[model samples]
Structure formats: structure tokens, C-alpha cells
Target: MRTLITIVAFLSFGLLSEIQAQEKHEILSPQEFCDKMKSDDVQIIDVRTPKEYKNGHIKNSTLINFFDDDFKEQLSKLPEDKKILVYCRSGNRSGKASEILENLGYKNIYDLKGGMLLWEKAKTDCY
Candidate 1:
């Protein structure tokens, strides 16, 4: 019974820690994200497949396929010091990628709220 209680407590702590880490990197709206891209010296990362990115993506975004097995290895080429702005076709993948970057201790991470689709839909005269 004591062992069971300890295991449960450990699991709860681990889960809570993961949740807190994710919360530290919150997703931002498309407009807010675009504003940063325009004014700040930010690294725009497109976390989509190469094929998808080739079709269409935000201007000046570096293509980094999140599904690739060597995704983190590829990410190593990017400067750790730059502010990273990330997005996907939709919100799902970029959100996960942002969390991964956060876990890797990368500061200044921003995720596009509804991703590229929303950005294009908003069509707010942004690239």
C-alpha cells in the first residue's frame, strides 16, 4: 500500500510538471504573431512537411518538418538565441512543436493561434 501511494504521488507530480511547462509557452493570436514577425528579428519556423511547405507558407519561414525523425537534429542549426515564431497548417502540430522547444529550454517561443490557415484567412495585409 505504501509503494502504491508513492507511485501515484510520483506520477501526479510528473504530470503536473509537464502541464506547467506547456503553460509557460502559451499560443498567440495570428495578428499578434504577425506583428512580431514584422517588427522583431524573429525566426519564423514552419513545422510542416517539406511537401506541404513547398505548396505555400508564410514568407521567410524556415521549413522544419516536425514529422521527420531528425527534426531536433535539424533544429540544432537554428540559433538558440533568436526569438522563434512557429506555425503549422493548423494549430495542432505547431503547438506540440512549441512545447518541445520549451522543454529543450529554448526561450522566446511563440505559436500561431490558428496556424497558417487562419493567418491566410485573416488576410490582414501581412506576409
Candidate 2:
């Protein structure tokens, strides 16, 4: 019985890991995100906290912090019809946020590959 339980647990963990890996957001390079942003009706979202946003962010990007207590409430304000380009300080939070956005029925969700860190490395201009 113990052996059977162990086997079940292992299989469950493996399956869960596989599902999470499959559900991860697609990572886009800085230039790829930039090109997409140039198109009309694209929405640039900074998923960093308000403090991080105040420090610096992409020009014309709106803040909808992924960690905010009212994150879902704020996210509801974003236009569902537009493509969303989301970024954070190091891409971790933005990746998670993109997944959430996808689950929310967003069709065109994008994740900044290295987050704002790579954007800054590419010397892209920000506000």
C-alpha cells in the first residue's frame, strides 16, 4: 500500500509539473515586443508594483501590478479587444501575469523575454 501511494504521488507530481510547463507564457524578445507595440490598438502593461512603476517604465504603458491586492479589479479595466504586451522588472512576475491574462480570456497576450531588465539592456527608451 505504501509503495502504491508513493507511485501515485510521483505520477501526480510529474503530471502537475508537465501541465505547468505547458501552461507557461511564451517569452518574446525585446525587439519582437517592440515591433508588436508599434501596431495600433496594442496595450502595453507594466506588471511591476507601483513603486517599481514610479521608478521607471515603458513609455505610454499602463500600470496593473500583478501583486497588487486589487490586481484582478485593475486588470478588469484593460480593454479585452486589444493585444496586451506585459512586462516586469525581471520577467518572472510578467510571465505569471501573462498566464493569468490568458486564463482571463485574453487572446493576444505577450511576455517580455527578459522583462524590463532585457529591455534596459537593449537600451530601449522608457518613460
Candidate 3:
């Protein structure tokens, strides 16, 4: 009974930690994303393909293809202390990338709510 109690306590702690970690990640609208971009500590990441990126992307954003085999490896190189803003063509890829970032222990990750599609629809300027 003592061992069972200890196991339950340990499992509860683990679950609480996971929830706290997930809370650090957020989904932001285009306007909110733009506002955050003004901060010098924010690092913008475009997770689209090279060809898609060539069509257009946010100004001064870094290109990190989501489909590339080195996607996670590349993300691992980012400074964990800085705020990371990630987006893709639509919301799907960026959503997945944000999960990866969160799992990698990024404390301040922001994913664009609707990606470039909504960004453009909202008349947010792109490069």
C-alpha cells in the first residue's frame, strides 16, 4: 500500500509538470503575432517548404522547412531563452512544429493561429 501511494504521487507530479510545460506555448492571432514581432527578443521561424517560402514570407523570418529531416535538429539550435514565433502556409504545419518545440522544452513558443493564409486575409504585411 505504501508503494502504491508513492507511485500515484509520482505519476501526479509528472502529469502536473507536463501541463505546466504545455502552458508555456501559445497560439496568437496575426495582429498579436505582429505585435510580438516588434520585440527584439522574438525569433520568427517559417516552417514552409523552400519553394513555398520563395513565394513570400514574413520579413526577417528564418526559413526552417518543416518537411526536412533536420527540422527538429535545426529547431534544437535555437536559443531556448528567446521567444520563438513559428508559422507555415496554413495553420497545420506550424501547429505541429509548435508541439515539437514545446516537447523540446522551449518555454516561450508562439504559433500563428492561422498561418500565412489568415495573415494575408487579415491584410498583414508580408515580405
Point to the candidate with the largest TM-score.
3
Stretches of candidate 3 exceeding 4 Å from the true structure: 1-21, 124-127
For candidate 3, lDDT tens digit of each residue in 20-109? 765767899998899889898989999999999999899889999999999999999999878999999888999999889888888789
For each candidate, what is the lDDT? 0.85, 0.83, 0.90
Clashing pairs in 1: none
Clashing pairs in 2: none
TM-score of 2: 0.75
Residue range 44-122, candidate 2, lDDT tens digits: 9998988999988888899987878888777767898888899999989888788787777676788999888889888
lDDT: which candidate is best? Answer: 3
How do the residues 1-127 of candidate 1 rate in per-residue lDDT, one tens digit apiece? 9999999999999999997866756588887887888856689999999898988999889999999998987776777878899999888999888878877778888899999788888866575
- Span of 10 residues, lowest total lDDT, candidate 1: 19-28
Candidate 3 clashes: the total is: 0
